[model samples]
Target: MESALAARLAAAPEEGIAPVHFVWIVAKDRASGTPSPMGIWSGDEDLTVTVALPDGTTASRAYLGGLGLEVEGLQYVADLTDNPVTVTLSQIAPAAQALVRGLDVRLAPVEVHATTMTGGALTSAPQLQWVGIVDEGPISTPAAGGAGGIALSIRSEIMTQLGQVNPAKSSDVHQKRRAAGDRFSEYAAVIGERKMQWYKR
Candidate 1:
C-alpha cells in the first residue's frame, strides 16, 4: 500500500471500509499481435478507477461488475504452504465459452487492487493488493443447466519464479555462462561417480 493509503486504513476499521477488488488481466498473448486489457471489479455498479499497470504506470480502467467473481486462497498463514489464488469468473455460459477459450491469459501479468477500508468517499486511489502471473485457465461448461465458469490459477511472482526449472546445470557449459574460466562444476559429473574407501577401511 502507498503511504497515504496505509495511513487512512490505519485509522479506518476493517469492517467499516468496503474493500473493492479490481482485477486487470490481459485478454490475449503478445505473440497473437493483438493483446488487450480486461478489467473487472467487485462492486454493485460499474465505474472507472485508477489502476497500476505492469510497467508501474497508472491508467484509468473501466471495471465491469455483476459478472460474479470469487477469489480464493488470499490468506496469510503461519504454515509453509505455497498456495495459488484461484479466481473463478462465474456465470459464463456455454455460448461464451468460445470467447473465453480465445483468451491467451497464461503467463499474463495480473494486478489486484482494492479501495481503502472506507468506501469511495476517500480521494486516495485504489491500492495494489496482490500481483501474480496466470499459471493456467481451465474452463468448465455445464451439460444441462448447472453453473460453470473459468477458473484462473494465479501464482505469486515469488512462487512462480521458484517453480521455474533453471536451465543452468552443474556442468562445464553451464559454468562457462557465468564466467569463462569458471570450472567449479567441471568435475561435478565425475565426482558423484567416484567412490570413497571409508566404508571398507
Candidate 2:
C-alpha cells in the first residue's frame, strides 16, 4: 500500500514544510504477529521511536547515542548500518540531533492525505493523497546555518508487502522491514493529517 515518496514530496509546499511530523501505529494484523493488509491499530498521541542496539555490552550506550543524549558516564557512539536513526523530538527540539543512528523500519502501504496552506495563496490547497511509508527519519543539525532539514525516504508499500498476498516473494528481511515501514508510515500519515488539518481548516 506504500505510495511513491517522490510523488508526495513533489506535492508538498516548497515553503513552510518545517515542523513536520508523522504518527504511526502497528498494523492490526501485525499486532497479532501475522502478515496481512495494513490496518489502523491506534491513534497518534503516544508513539515513540525505538532504537535497538547490537546485542552486546555496547547496546545500551548505542541506544542513548542515537538520542544525542550526553550523560556523564555515557558517550555517544555512531553506528551506521543502513538504518535510520531515532530521536526523541520535542517542541523546542523539532528534530533529532546529528550523529545519532538507528534503522529505518519498513512497512506495508498505508493511505496518506495531506492538506496545506500556502502563505500567498488564500484557501487551503487540495489534499494530496497517496500511499507510502517513511523508510527513514530526518537528520537535524544546529538551528541556524545547518542542513535546513531532512527528508524521509518513502517508497511504495506494495514493493515489499508481498508475504500474505504473494507467498512466493518470501524474504525475512523484506517482511520485517515491511512491517516496520507500515507502522511508521501509517502513523506518519495519520499524524500529519491531524496536525495540518486544524490549521488548514
Candidate 3:
C-alpha cells in the first residue's frame, strides 16, 4: 500500500513551482529619484552572472558561495548570495546626492500665502478656516485620508523609519526563492534520471 501511494505521488504533476531565487538590484534610478535593485537571479551552487556597468563595459563570470563584485570607477556593488543576487549602489553619488539632499530638504511642507475665494468672489468674509489643524470631534475621532493613502503612508513611514528594512525583506525573499528553485532543480534531476532508467528498462 505504501509503495503504491509512493508511486502515485511520484507520478503526480507539480502544481505551483515558485522561483527559487529573488534578486534585489539596489541602484539609483537616473530618471526617478529612488533606490532600486536591478535584477535578481536564482539557481543552485553553480551560476553565471553577467554584469553590465553604467560605463559601456560588461563582464561575465561564474561565481561560487556569496559573490561580491565591485568595479573601481563604478559606484555600485553586486552581491550574489545562495538564492538571489543583490546589487546596491551608493546613495550618495557625486552628481545625484546634492539633488537628493535638496529633495529631502523640500519634503517639509513650504508655507505659501494664497488668496481664498468665497462664493466665486473675493469676499472679505471672516470665517475660521481649519488650516493646518486637526479637529478631534466628538462621537468619533477625526478621520485621516483614504484607506489606500493611509496604508501607503504607513508603509512609507515604516520603510523610512527602518532604513535597513528593505535589505532584510530582500534577503528573506531571496532565501525563499532560492529554496524553491533548488527544490525544482533537484526534482528535475530526479525526473531525468527516472526517465533514463525507464528507457533502459
Candidate 4:
C-alpha cells in the first residue's frame, strides 16, 4: 500500500502546491470512552499544520510541496475532494509516507509553556518546553520478522504569564534577540544531526 502511494506522489507535478499536514482530532465516545476520527481538512495555512521530521525538527513551512500529502495506510485521505490543488496522503513522498503510516502526523508545533520563576525583586521569567514525539510501536507485522516503522505523536501545552516587553527599548530588545538567536543556534545543531541521521539511512 505504501509503495503504491509513493509512486503516485513521485509522479505528481510541482506548482502552487504545498506540503500535506495531518492532525488526529480524536473524539471520545461519551458513553464508552472510545475515540474515533472525526473531520479532517487540508490547507496552506502554516498555523493549521506542523511537520515533525525525524531529525527532531518541527516546521510549519510547506517543504513537502505536493509530495508530502500522499501517505498510505492512513484513513484521513481516502476520499478527499475539496480542491484540485490538494493531494491525498497516498501521493506524498516516500519518506513522508513512511513517517505517516499509522501515525497521527501534525504540521504544527505542540507548544510547551515554561514554568515561571519569581524573585525577591519582582522579577519574572518565562519558560518554554518544545514538544517531543512519542513513538507508539512498529508498523509492520512482527510475525513476518520485518523491521516495523515508528509512529510519531505530539501534543500541545500552554505557557502563560509571559513577560511582554516593549519592542522599542533597544537594551531589552537586544537582550531578548540575543537569547533567541542562541536558542535558534542550538536548535539548528540538533536539526543538523537529525538530517545526517536521515541521510545515513
- Number of the top-ranking candidate, with lDDT as the measure: 1
TM-score of each: 0.71, 0.26, 0.15, 0.19
Query: Per-residue lDDT of 32-121 in model 2, one digit per residue for the tens?
Result: 544333111112222232212123121111111122211111112364223222212321322232211222233423333223223422
Name the 10 consecutive residues with the lowest summed lDDT in model 2. Answer: 56-65
Cα lDDT tens digits for candidate 1, 1-201? 677677766766753554557787766744664766777766656778777766789889887766566677776667655678877786463312432565667677788777654545533677676788888888777889687688888878787677679876779888888899998888887888988798685
User: Between 1 and 3, whose TM-score is larger?
Assistant: 1
- Candidate 3 lDDT score at position 9: 39
For each of the candidates, give the backbone clash count.
1, 22, 8, 16
lDDT of 4 by residue, 13-40 (tens): 6522223334323333444655433222
lDDT measured at residue 168 in model 2 versus the true structure, 0 to 100: 39
The models' CA-based lDDT, in order, is 0.71, 0.31, 0.27, 0.32
When sorted by lDDT, best at the front, the candidate numbers are: 1, 4, 2, 3
Q: For residues 4-100, what per-residue lDDT tens digits would candidate 3 score against the true structure?
A: 3334335446532221221222334455757532332222244445433334365454422122211111112344211211122233233223322
lDDT accuracy of residue 101 in candidate 4: 51
Residue 32, model 1: Cα distance from true site in angstroms: 2.0
Off by more than 4 A, model 2 = 1-92, 95-111, 116-128, 138-144, 162-201
